[model samples]
Target: MARARICKPCLWTALLGIGFLFIWYFKVLALGYYWLSTTVNAAQWEGSSLWLPGYQVAVEARPIEGLTRNTSGLTFNNETGTLFTVINRPPQIAELTTDGRLLRVIELEGARDPEGITYVQGDTYVISDEHSDSMYWVRIGPDTRHVSIAARSSLGIRIDSVHNSSFEGVSWDSEQNRLFVVKEKLPLRVLVIKGLDVFSESRGFNIDISEWKSSSAASLFMSDLSSLTLHEPTGHLLLLSDESALVVEYAPDGQPIGMLPLWRGFNGLQRKVPQPEGLAVGPDSALYVLSEPNLFYRFERIQKPAVAAN
Candidate 1:
């Protein structure tokens, strides 16, 4: 009986220590250290010290009107000189002008939880459904009101067992005819797929999927991926992270080249960008961003004020 009492106290003490360690690792040490590193890296990328100066928000976060539902991915439509964003609630598409004027909303009945949209070619787009972990090819126009998946071709890739953390964002490389899809989190990966619309004699639409190996290194900079956009002019990638509130710039080789903090102090904003969901780069190299609960933001490269000659 005496020995049992001593062991009981010892066991309770051990359990308490283990619990403290768990909290320290995940809540304190891990997150604290990561935030510190992210801030330092961002400073280096944004400060004038770096060769490639980072971008800053030219305008403030604009409240998007007529978009009542939650917005997800965004893609710049080169042909129209506009942008397209997805609504996951009813799985619809919203067309907006450069200034964020809502042009129209097209209802997509069969697009389940559409989280990403990317323009593939003339009137053709690839939309990703997070719940289904699938991609659908469809076309829309000025008068088009409704769309379905019956006439579309879909390719499903299961990347995560968690339904919500599946495919979250996608970017189309029109020049190379490749598609890059981002797994939301849980070892966040970027899958590069080629031959999306190509076919072979033995295999139909023989799509080849590969991962950008360097994304593993880049993932260390962000918490989770909310959207992705490719800047055609620079052939660089802009990765949006909602949790970290950042837009990370990755080179063609997938190395993290720069990062723009989506915070109030960093950018010319009175408030921070909350829940950024979509990102797109216009043909003029202007950056467009969308946040949940209907918010739009624009960023551009502006000339730095010349320092007075010393």
Candidate 2:
């Protein structure tokens, strides 16, 4: 009987093809897993039942020029009663008074898309560029402006890893001495730094954002949360979504407390605010909302419930 003949060359080629297929399958799976994990961790705060009901007091149309198109980050200084917003397409930080007057504008050229802004102390502020994980500390003086590197870590609160996308919002808790940074969209998480005192000690530190909690993930209702601001007096977080035309207020525990909706009259002015991006609370408790390009809205909080008028 003739011994069974085996095709040695064909067998080797088939084995090589199988090995390549396994490699390709794993490559795609690894990429997909990384994306899925990042998204889940980024938006981990969704489905939180903790939130308050926000009321729509008023919606002022786009009140400024220059801001009509690409507003990214927003912050309010209670001490000065000023609102700061970053217009990314041209990279300009525009300042406005509580009465909706454009006070000043600072150009930030070489900076990546500045997505978040917060006033730390006198003349010192921190800005985050969503395109990169680097954060900048800028010093504004009476006459000259200087920029320095403050914190340079991808230490996002809700992101699963530092390799994910950039950050969007920043809120400083002076009383608690913590910094809260928000990641845009899915698995919305807030990065909390426990001991902010040490932020200056070392360059920066990374905290697992998955551990920090939010009352609600604004992305569930409004998918694109462009910016966030914490109201110290009320412990409420104001979220702005450039795509939803709505601003929502959430409790620290992630509850859906209240919300404010934009009006349609803005279209009549040829300046419709399809995207309400940045948010800041004025000293008077008035909310300042800014949209892309150059549009600003002011909303005074509705009167709180009276206690029997006693």
For 1-310, candidate 2 gives per-residue lDDT tens digits of: 8998999999999999999688556645643453354335433322231121222335456457534567767787755667777767767777777656777778776666777888777766777777666556666554533343443323323244343344787877676766677777554555665555423535565433333454322223554567777766556667776665656666566654454555454312233455676777766556677766566676653443211100
TM-score versus the correct structure, for each prediction: 0.81, 0.67
Candidate 2, run of 10 with poorest lDDT: 45-54
What 10-residue stretch in candidate 1 is worst by lDDT?
Answer: 301-310
RMSD of candidates 1 onward, in order: 6.0, 11.0
The models' CA-based lDDT, in order, is 0.75, 0.59
lDDT of 1: 0.75
Best by lDDT: 1
Tens-place lDDT digits, model 1, residues 1-310: 4553468888899999998677445544544554555456764444331212345677677777899768999998877888898998877899998888899999888877999999877778889998788888878776777888665678889865476887888998877888989888876777899987722222257779998755444244566788887765456677788887877666576656566778787756678898999988776567788999688888866643122100
Stretches off by above 4 angstroms in model 1 are: 1-53, 198-203, 215-219, 304-310
Q: Model 1, clash count? A: 0
> After aligning candidate 1 to the native by TM-score, how far in Å is the CA of 284 from where it should be?
1.3
lDDT of model 2, residue 278: 77
